[model samples]
Target: MEENFKMVAKTLFGFEEILAKELLQLGAQKIEKGVRSVSFYGDKGFMYKANLGLRTAIKILKPIHAFSVHNENDLYNAIYKMPWENYLSPKGTLAIDATVHSPLFKHSLFIAQKTKDAIVDKFRNTTGQRPNVDLKFPDIKINIHIDRHQCTVSLDASGESLHKRGYKTATNIAPINEVLAAGMILLSGWDGQCDFMDPMCGSGTILIEAAMIACNIPPNLMRKEFAFERWQDWDVDLFEKIEASLLNKTRDFHYKITGYDKAPSAIAKARENIKYARLEDFVHVQHEDFFKTRKGGHQKLHMVFNPPYGERLNIDMQDFYKNIGDTLKQNYPGTDAWFITSNLDALKHVGLRPSRKIQLYNAKLEARLVKYVMYEGSKKQKYMK
Candidate 1:
């Protein structure tokens, strides 16, 4: 039987709870949430499953060692004492990614370089051979994190960011991150209950993520590679078994997932991405200005999107935001609209009081995910300030 080991899944800010819940559902034990990260105990196969199944996780890391380091020499000596031979050969390629939050260490790159030097020097002294660095494709990807006087070293189980879901072949200007898109849909609490729409869908990221969530599909199933696949103990059969298990758990989605864009080029790119993800059967995309269209059918609709935040697209911010509110108030009823924007000033022009406003971040910009509920009937709706 395989032994259980502790692993941590890092995510964006404000997604730790959702990521922890995802780990819990995946049968992980000892689940605990930290700032922007979740730690759990699982075996090798469970590691594969977590990497494949988690939607909001940025990367899953297996902690090998932790120590108190007061200076660079302590950090180097601690790293040199590790059994790197168990994970990679002296001839294999390697990569180091470091993050520092301590006043003692200001440059993460220098820390990474010091780590690389320590590992290579140890190997060369012992075996007269050293591993080379390959940032893009490495046999072993190492993560170094220093917080105050404590340092933790881990092996990155997911090579690239999990956000690279391998579905988007093309992108429009300022496309939303896949991890962010999935997190947004989950935050909206859309469980494929009714129709879903991304009225300003760009490259169809939100729509693809929504379909996957609604159908219980694993997000990383289509990813090109994971860092674990190159490890010394890589298990193809175990990975396939985990994949099959996840596939077996997938439930069919009954509601339609739709996307719209004013640009024909965006529509084309969205269709291409949706087709790539093999979600065309469940999703539909069209080129239509959302302001000029009205909601169809009587069933309740759930909408989530990342509309223009006035930074990339050249548009009048005040008028554009007003039109969004006007369209929802006049054309759409029985609908719940949710969107994220960095422009808090423009958000005021929406004119409807947000029942829920959650603070989040879009890369570096502070953003808000606001929700506005449009009533079902012709009864007078309270448009709060």
Candidate 2:
């Protein structure tokens, strides 16, 4: 039997709790949460399961070594002493990604270079040959983290970010990150119980993620690759078993999941993405300006999307936000409307107050994931002050 080891699942801001919950539900042991990360114990097959199943995780890392370092030499010496041959061949290609939160190491790039140098130098000294650096597609990807002089070197189990689920061949002007899209739906507390909609679905990322969530589908079932596939001990049979196990757990979703966009181009892109995901049966995309549309049914509706944050696409910030509020209040009754935007000023113009506002970051921009509940009956929209 394979022995269990510790692994860390990295996620975006405000998603640690949900990621932790996901790990727990997936049968992870001794789960611990960190800022934008969750650490837990699982065996090799479980690691395969995590990379395949975790929706919010950007990357899954297996920490191989941890030490205290104060200077560059210390970092190099630490990495050189490790048995890199166990994970990669001397002729294999390698890539290093580093994150520094310590005052001692000011440059993350330099650290990455130094780590890469140490590994290749070690290979050259021992085997008379060294691995080449291939940043794009490497046989091994390493992660270096320094926090308050404590350095940890980890093997990245997921090569590219898990967000590249291989289903999005097309995108609109401003497509939301797949990880963030999945996190938003999970945080909204929608579990396939009600109808789902993304009113301003740009390329239908939110809609696809929401539909996957509602159907209890593994987020990365359609992913092209995981870093572990190139490892020295890559177990094809074990990975297949894990994939089969996750697929068996998928549940059927009965409610409708839909998206609307004003632009015909966006509608076309959304349709393409939905089709790529093989979710055409469960999701529908339409060309309609959200501000001009009304709720179709009396069923409880769950809405989540990322509207224009006035960053890339050119749109009237204040007026667009006001229209969002007016449409929800006047038309979308019995609905829980949630949207994320970096435009703090524009949120005020929405007119309707948000019942919940959670702080998060959309890349470098500070953003808010706000929620507004519209009443079903005679009760007017309660604008929380």
Best by TM-score: 1
Tens digit of per-residue lDDT, candidate 2, span 290-310:
988999878899999899877
Which 10-residue window in model 2 sums to the lowest lDDT?
Answer: 376-385
RMSD of each: 2.1, 2.2
Distance from true location, Cα of 197 in model 1, Å? 0.6
TM-score of each: 0.98, 0.97
Off by over 4 Å in 1: 378-385
lDDT of 1 by residue, 1-385 (tens): 9999999999988898889989999999999999999999999999999999999999999999999999999999999999999998999999999999999999999999999999999999999999999999999999999999999999999999999999999999989999999998899999898999999998999999999999999999999999999999999999999999999999988888989999999999999999999999999999999999999988999999999988888899999999999999998898999999999999999988899998888988999999998987654543431
